[model samples]
Target: MEFNIPGIVNAAIPTRQDRNRNVMIISSNSGGSYNDSGFLSSDFPHSPAKLYITAESDSFDAQTLRDWRDEGFNVEYLPLGDGGSAYAARLESLAKSNNLGPCQSYGIIAYGDAASFCLEHFHVVDNNPEFKLGCLVAYYPARIPDPRGKFPSPVRAIVHLAAKGEDSIDVVGHSQMLGIQGSRRVSRRRLDRGVGAGRALDMAYPAYRYDAEPGFAEHDLDEYDRVSAELAWSRSLAVVRRALMGYMDADASVVDQNTDGKFVTRNLSQTMGTYTAHRSPHVTYMPTLTGAIDSQELQRFYSEYFLNKNPPSTELTLVSRTVGSDRVVDELHVSFKHTQEMPWILPGLPPTNKRVEVMVVSIVTLKAGKICHEHVYWDQASVLMQVGLLDPKMIPQKASERGVKKLPIVGREAARRVLQGFEDEEDGEADNELIPGWYDDEEEEEEKDEQEGKKENTGKKTKLQEEKGKQPEKASVGPETRDEDGQAETIPERAKSEPKEVEA
Candidate 1:
C-alpha cells in the first residue's frame, strides 16, 4: 500500500534537535494554501516534526500552503479519495513512508471531520511497530462517534465539542459514548459558548451566536472567544506534549488542592526559602493583594483569599500539566460552591451560593530552579456569570435563562438523563435532499458550452499565433519608465501608446 504523496520534511532547530518529536496534522478540507513562513520559534520547548496533510496536491492556496511550510511542518497535499478503507490505507502508507518509530515520538492532530474519521480508524496505526501514536486530539468534531463499537481502539484521546445550544449534535450521547468505552482514557469536555468546531484550536474562526443585535449579540458578537480558545489550546498542547514527549514534576512550593477539600502548603520551609521573597504583581480579577506581594504577602493572600475567606467548597481539579525545559504549564478546572461572599474576588457582590465551574491555565517560569514568574489565565466573564455576580441580560453570556448545567457531567445515570431530554435533530436539513441525481442540469449545460467554446476557439488562432503559443514569448527590449525612487519599471501598453515627446 503505497501513497504517491509529495511531501516536504522539516527538522527542528539545532538547540532542540535532541528533543525533536513528530506530529502529523490531518486537515479536514481537500486543498489548502502552500505559501507559508514555516518558522517555528525557540519558545516551543519541544521539537516536534509537524506533518500537515491535505487531500489535494495540485489545488491549494499559495499563501496558506507557504504559511504551513514556514512553520517548519512537513506538508503533503494529495487527495485522500472517498471511502473509509481508502482513508485507512493512506494513513498506513503515510506512517510507513515516514519511517516513524518509538525513538521519534509521534502524535496525531485530526481537525473537524478528519478527527471523526481518524478516531474511527485510529487503530490502523496502533499495532504498527514503526508508528505508535502516543496521544490523539480530536479538535471539534461534528458528533463524537460511539467509541464502544466492535472495533475498539485502545488509545487515550480527548474530544472537544462546541456548545452552540441550538439545533446541534447530541453532545451528551457523545460524552456518554466516550465515558462508557473501555479504553485507556477518554475525557470529554464541553466548551460552552463555543459557536463552531475548530473554533477552540483556531482563534481566527468566528464563534457561534444566537441573537442578532442589541439582544444577546452585544458582548457575544465576536467570532473568537479569546479566553475559551486560549484555555482549550493550552490544555490541548499540554496533553500532546505529555503524551508524546512525556512530563516531569516541577519542584515548587505552592498551595495544593487536596482531595479532602483543604488548601495545604506542602514543604512550606523549602518552598519559601527557594523564592526571592519579593512582592509579586497580581494582574487577574482577584484584587485582594496587588503589586509585588512578597512571601509574607503571599502567605497572607493564601490565608485571607484562599483558606479563610474562600468558600469551603472551593476546589481546583488538575486537568492537564506540561513540564517544559524553562516553564511548567498547568491547566485546572476551578470550581466552588459560592456560600460565602469574598470581596477579594468579586469586588462588590454578595454570595449567591451558586455552584461555579471555570477552567484556568497557569504558566510558571523558573529561574535557576526557583519560581521567577507565573501567568495565570481564566475567563472572568464566565466566572462572573457562574457566581451570579454578573447579570446575563445586561451582558451577553452563556449563563443566561438557559438551563445548561455546569460542566463535568457527573455519572453515567446523569449523562443518560441529560441526553434523554433532547431530541436527536438532523445535522443537516431533513427536508432537503443531499444527494444529487445522476445528471446535473447546470453542469450539463456548462459542459455543452465548454465544448462549443473549444470548437469556436479551435479555428480562431492563426498558424503563427498557434506556433508562438507553443514557445515562450521573447522579451523585446524597450524604453523603461522611472518611478519617484528612480527604479526602472516596465511601461504598460497603454502608457507606451503615448507619442514619444520631442527630444528637448
Candidate 2:
C-alpha cells in the first residue's frame, strides 16, 4: 500500500492577509530598479509584510517587480518627485493610507542620501503619533544622528555603516573614523560620577559595521560581498520581524519527510515536493560537490544518482539535532556496506564490499514551511580510508624526509569515537597516537626499573645462600632423545653420560 504525507506531498495554501504590516524602501538612486537595492524581493516574497518602493521616478526594472509579485508579495512603486514639503506630504499621506489599521504601523528602509535625510528628520515621526512609525533601518548614510541621543519610545532604529570612510558623529568629543580594514578606535572620557563613558552612551541604537565598502550588501553592485550581505540580511530581517511581529516558524516535519523520501522510501516525487514551491530550492553535499540547485536539477540528480543508489543495508543514527527559527541542524552517524555503486559519496568507484561508517552534519533552511536549501558535510578523507581508496603510508617523499610516516586519517575508528562520546561510554581509544615519541620516555623508565629490581633480588639471594652455608642445587640437563615407531633406542651407560675431565 502507498501513503502520502499531507504537507510534504502537497504545498500549503497561504493565509489571507487582511492586516499585513507595511514596509517602505527609500532609495537615493534616481532612476534604478528594485534590483539596484541591497535587498532581494524574492527573499521576502512570502513574508507577512507589504513592501512599498518610494523613489524619484516610477520607472523600474519591470521584470524585477514581476518577479516580486510572483513570489506572493503585494509590491507597489510610489513616486516622490522633489524633496522638502512635497516629499513629507506624500509620506504623511502614506501614513494615513486606508490599508493600515488604527493599531498598525509601518517601517522605513533608506539608503545613502535618503538614509541621511530620514535620520536627520526622524523627529517628524517622533513628534507626531499619527505617523505610526514602527522602525527605521539606514544603510551607509552620508551622516548619522548624534549617538548619545535616543529615539522615542515604541520606535526602533538601527544603522549599517561602511568601514571604508569617516562618520560625522563624534564619540567622547573625538571624531569617529572608520578604517578601510574595518578598524574602529574610540576614546573614552571619564564622567564626574566615576563612570566610564563612550560606547555605553553611544549605543542608543544597534549599529553594525561591515568590513566592505559602500554597496556591499547590494546584489547588483560591483562591491557586493556575499558574506557581508548575508550577515546584514539576517540582522535586518530580525529587526523587521521583531518590530512588525512577523515571525514565521519553520516546520521541521517537512525536513523529516524529505529525509524519509530520500533515504528510506526512495521516492523522487515525494522528495521534490518537500522543497519550497515559491522559489528555486537547492541542496549541496559539500564533500563530493554532489546534489543540485533548483527543482528540475534536484529532481534529475536524485532520480538518477542519489535516491536509488544507496546500499540496502544502509543505517542512519541521529547523534544530535538542533531546531532553530528557520532551520534545522542534524549530526548523524551513517553506516553502510559498499555492496553496490554509490555515486553520492564515492563516485566512479567499483564496489569493494567494505563496511563504511562516517559522521555527517546536515543544515536545512526552510521558507514558508518548505525546504529552501540544504548543506551536508562529512569527512571525505575518512570515507576514502574506509573504502581502501586512500593509503596513509603512501605519502610524498618530502613528507617522509620530514619524519612523517603516515597520514593522520583514521577509518571507521573516527565514527566509533564520536558514537562512544555521544553514548557517554568510557573512551577506549588513546589520543595523540600520530605524535612521534608520545610514550617513549614512560616505557623506557619502566623497563629500566624492572631490570634494576631483578639485579637487586639476585644479589640478595646469593648473599643469603653464602651466609647460611647452603649451596644451591646443581642445574640438571635433560637427554635429547626420540623413539621411533614400533622400536625403542638402547639407553647409553651412566658413566658415558658424565662429562670427562681434561688435563688442561
Highest-scoring model, TM-score: 2
**What Cα-based lDDT does every candidate model obtain?**
0.44, 0.63
The residue-by-residue lDDT of candidate 2 on 146-228, one tens digit each, is 45545543456777776544333323211222311112224432222211421122345667666568777655568877666
Name the regions of candidate 1 deviating beyond 4 angstroms. Answer: 1-87, 123-131, 149-154, 166-222, 248-504
lDDT of 2: 0.63
Tens-place lDDT per residue, model 1, 94-193, is 6566665323434565545565566555532233323344455555555454333322121335655544453344321222231222223234544344
Each prediction's RMSD over C-alphas, in Å, is: 33.0, 16.1
Overlapping backbone residue pairs in candidate 1 total 28
lDDT of 1 at 483: 47
**Pairs of colliding residues, candidate 2:** none
Residue 95 miss distance in model 2 (angstroms): 4.1
